[model samples]
Target: MVIYGVYIVSKSGGLIFNHDHNIPKVETEKVFSFPIDLTLEYDPKKVSVAFGQKDGINVGHILTSINGVAVNGNTTEEGNDVKELIENEGNYPLTLKFSRPKMTTNEKIFLASMFYPLFAIASQLSPEPKSSGIEVLEADTFKLHCFQTLTGVKFMTVAETTQTGMDVFLRKIYELYSDYVLKNPFYSLEMPIRCELFDANLQGLLEQIEKTGITNI
Candidate 1:
C-alpha cells in the first residue's frame, strides 16, 4: 500500500523527524503509539520539516494534541518544556480524530498525476547555466541540477557536473519537485506546462541575477 507520512530533514543527511498516520478507521476511538525514528546524527535544532498530506488534503488543521505537545504550522513546538517531552521520549500516542478519512489508491494516483506539469514548467523556466556552473557544451547538451529539478522536468540534453555537485543538485531537485509541484492539485498533466506565477517569480529572480551581472552561473 502507498503509505502516507511526513519526513523532515536537514541540509545535512539527517532524518531528524518522521511520523506515519497509519491508523485504520475502525480504530479511531483507540489510541496508538508510534515511534519517532531519528537518525543517529540528527540534530533537531537545524532541521526543517517537510509535510506531505496524502494527496494534498488539508490535514494541518486536523493535527492536534490531547497530552504531550503538538507542533502545528510545520515547525516543531519550541521551548525548554517541549525538549523535556523529548527527553522523556517513549511510546507517545497522540489521538488523531478526523472527520474525513484516508484516500483510496485511485484517488492518490489521480491527484499525483494532476500536479505533474508543475515539474515541467520548473524545468522550462530554469535559466541556462554558464560554462562553470551550467552550460550548453554543445547544441544538444545542457547542464542542469536543482534548477531543473525544482521545476519537475529533466533536460533533453546531458549535464556534465563533478560527481559530488551532481549528486547534491539531483537530490535537491528531486525533493523540491516531488514535494512542492507534484503534490499540488490545480496542476494537471493533460494541459501544457505554464505557470504564470512561477514565471513571474522566476523572472524576478533572473532580473536580480542580471542586476548583479551574474546571469550565467
Candidate 2:
C-alpha cells in the first residue's frame, strides 16, 4: 500500500496544502483500468488491480486515453472531459492508458483546484437532491479518497488500491487540522497551512503510519 501524497483544498476551491511522499521508482510502461460506477448492472469490483512497479502505473502518470478516445490536458477541462466520458454508461470495462511523467508541484495544485468545480458539478448533476459529491476515485494503480468537512474543507489522500481504513485516517487528519490549524491564532482561515505544530503533528502521524503500517489511525 503506497501513499503517494495528500492534498487539502479550501472551501472555495483553493489548494491549502500539498504533500508528496518520497518513494523511489523507475519509469516503466504499463496499462490498467480506472474503476468507475455506472447505472448499468456491471459490478465495479470486477476490475483488476495494478500489476506492480515493474509494469504497473502509479502517480504522476498522465492519462492519455479512455477506451479508444484520446484525452489531453491535465487541467480542469481535461478532468471534466474524462468525467463526462466515464459517466457514459456505454463505456464499460473502462480501458485507461497512461504515460508516466513526474507531476510538478504546480500541476498538483492545479489538479486540486480543478477538482473543486468538478465536485460541485457532480452534486448539481445528481438526480437525487442534496447529494454528496465524489468520495472515492479508484484507478488500477491508485485510489483517491476524499473527506469533506461540514464547513466545506476537503482532505484528500492518494494511495494504492490495497490501502485500507483510509476514511478513518482522513477523519483523523481533519481532527489534526482542527486542533492545530483552526485553533492557531496565527493561522489564516482558508489559507495555506503553515503552523509549526500542524506540520510536526502531520509528519509524526505519517511517520507512525510508515513505521507501523497502521493506516487505521
Q: Give TM per candidate.
A: 0.22, 0.63
TM-score of 1: 0.22
**Candidate 1 structure quality by residue, lDDT tens digits, 5-95:** 3222222222322223333332112243553332111134322113433322223223223243443322335533333333353736543
Off by over 4 Å in 1: 1-135, 139-152, 155-183, 215-217
Per-residue lDDT of candidate 2, residues 1-217 (tens digit): 6677888999999899987775445333333333432121112311112333324555344555665555555223234455555556665567765555556778878998899999999889999998889889899888999999898999999988898878887887899999989987877768898878877888877877877775435
**Model 2 reaches what TM-score against the true structure?**
0.63
**Clashing residue pairs, candidate 2?**
none
Instruction: Name the 10 consecutive residues with the lowest summed lDDT in model 1.
Output: 1-10
Error of 1 at 175 (Å): 9.2
Top TM-score: which candidate number?
2
